[model samples]
Target: MRLAGNLLLAVLVLAALAIAATYWRAGQREAAARAAYPPLGQILDVGGVQVHAHVTGAGPDIVLIHGAGGSLRDFTFDLAARLSDRYRVIAFDRPGHGHTDAADTAGRRFDAPRQQAALLQAAARQLDIARPLVVGHSFGGSVALAWALEQPGDTAGVVLLAGATMPWPGTLNASYRINSSLLGGALVVPAITAWVPLPYARQVLAGIFAPQPMPESYPAEFGLPMALRRGLLRANARQVNGLRPHVVEMSGDYPGLEIPVELLHGDADEIVPLHVHSGPLSALLPDAVLTVLPGVGHMPHHAMPDHVTAAVDRVAERAGLR
Candidate 1:
């Protein structure tokens, strides 16, 4: 009896040590992440959440929303700076990404793109971004669609860069499924934030931008540490995992869309398939234009910034804003 009791005590002690270590490492990582990648934009108090908006240049307004696991830095690195010369470029760190806090503290209800769009719209109003041309990449594209749908009068045009629109086959990626769950988010997420290696993260990023080279300095310049922080990781996982069903519901509303849309997708994109998303979406919308990049992959904004800028210019022309 004493032997069994001692063995149980040892297990309990080890478990307690593991939990304590996880929390300690998580705290250290969070601090390091903040120090390494401090906010580059002004934080706006938009109702329940604080949004990070980076504004530059002075011309017609163009709001840029980045993909999952990305921040405003993704655009500011090159694209936003380039576009700024011709347009007033505003790049936003989406709710629960980068410096922005999640719209829902519970981290469940606000995973839908519509919820994110609403929060961004509110922030845009405060910033006086009127009838702006919105550009969204990957997951942000879905939010761009929702924004146009919810606030047509406020949106002049949309540019979707390999946007996830239609409901695709397959379950949520394994990492997202695990990290987004209650038990995993509470326990496993902190461990990942504490221990994931930079090389592995780079490898994953390379795959996403496969068939095209990622900019040499993108990982560091885009603030990788900020993306690996515990809270944002959980938020991204939840949003990505819960996205499919939301896309299904949102897809049905595409036919009624009136605003001009310009979609630029790569034929070789393995991340969000070109055939599944933009192809069908272009057909559904009345005023939609699709451009297929012959040899490009997912990150068109990086791989073909000229094409992306041209698309934005086309949308602006169509909207009579140019």
Candidate 2:
């Protein structure tokens, strides 16, 4: 019995050591990530949450919101610069995604699209962004929709580029399901933060951009390492895993959004399929123009930037900003 007790104690000690090592590694990685990619935008307080915003250029106001698992850097990289020439471009890190502080560490507080929209709108009000042309990519589209729905009078129009605006029939693949769970948060997320290599991230990015290749410089400039921080990974997982229901609720309000809207998607996009989202959204929106890129993927903005710019121009014209 004494020998068995010793073995059990030995196992417990080994397990404890392993967990400690994991946490130490995770912390080191997080520090390295932050040092590598410090916040490029200013931080503002929005209802107890610290929101990160980057504003540039001058003209009519234009707000840019990036998708899940992305920071505002995604926009600041190229699109924001592209739009900045003509419009005062304002980009923000959505709550829990970038430098912005999540109201709850587990990321439940802003899981609802409306919550994200309300918080971002408050930040915009702080910036004095009046009736801006709001642009969103992927999950950010849902938030843009919410902003228009909740404050129609305040928003001039919306531009959804490969947006995840509608609910889908199937469950998200295993990675999202596992990562969003309690067990995943306690064990898996830290491991991923500590050791998920760059190669794997590249692989995932490849998949996200599928047929269309990810720009070689994208990973470094995008701060992929910083995005893999444990808290952020967990937050992204929770927000995306819990998103479908909010989409279902938000979809019902689509027809009521009477503002000028622009929808653009790649026919080949698999992440937020064209058929499932933009295709159907064009018909639902009271005044929307859908632009389908024949052979592009999820990164439609990157793939066909001119088309995206044209769509913005159309929205501006329709909203009488042009």
| Top-lDDT candidate index | 1
Error of 1 at 207 (Å): 2.0
Residue-wise C-alpha lDDT for candidate 2, range 1-322, written one tens digit per residue? 9999999999999998988899899999999989999889788887668899999999999999899899899888789888888999999998888898867444447777899898899999999999999999999999889989999988899999999999898889787888889999888999998888888987887788878899899999998888888888877888899999998998899999999999999999988999999988898999998988999999888888888888898899899998
**Candidate 1, run of 10 with poorest lDDT:** 102-111
- lDDT of all predictions, in order shown? 0.90, 0.89
- Candidate 1 clash figure, as a count: 0
Worst 10 residues of 2 by lDDT: 102-111
Query: For each candidate, C-alpha RMSD in Å?
Result: 1.4, 1.6
- Quality of model 1 by C-alpha lDDT: 0.90
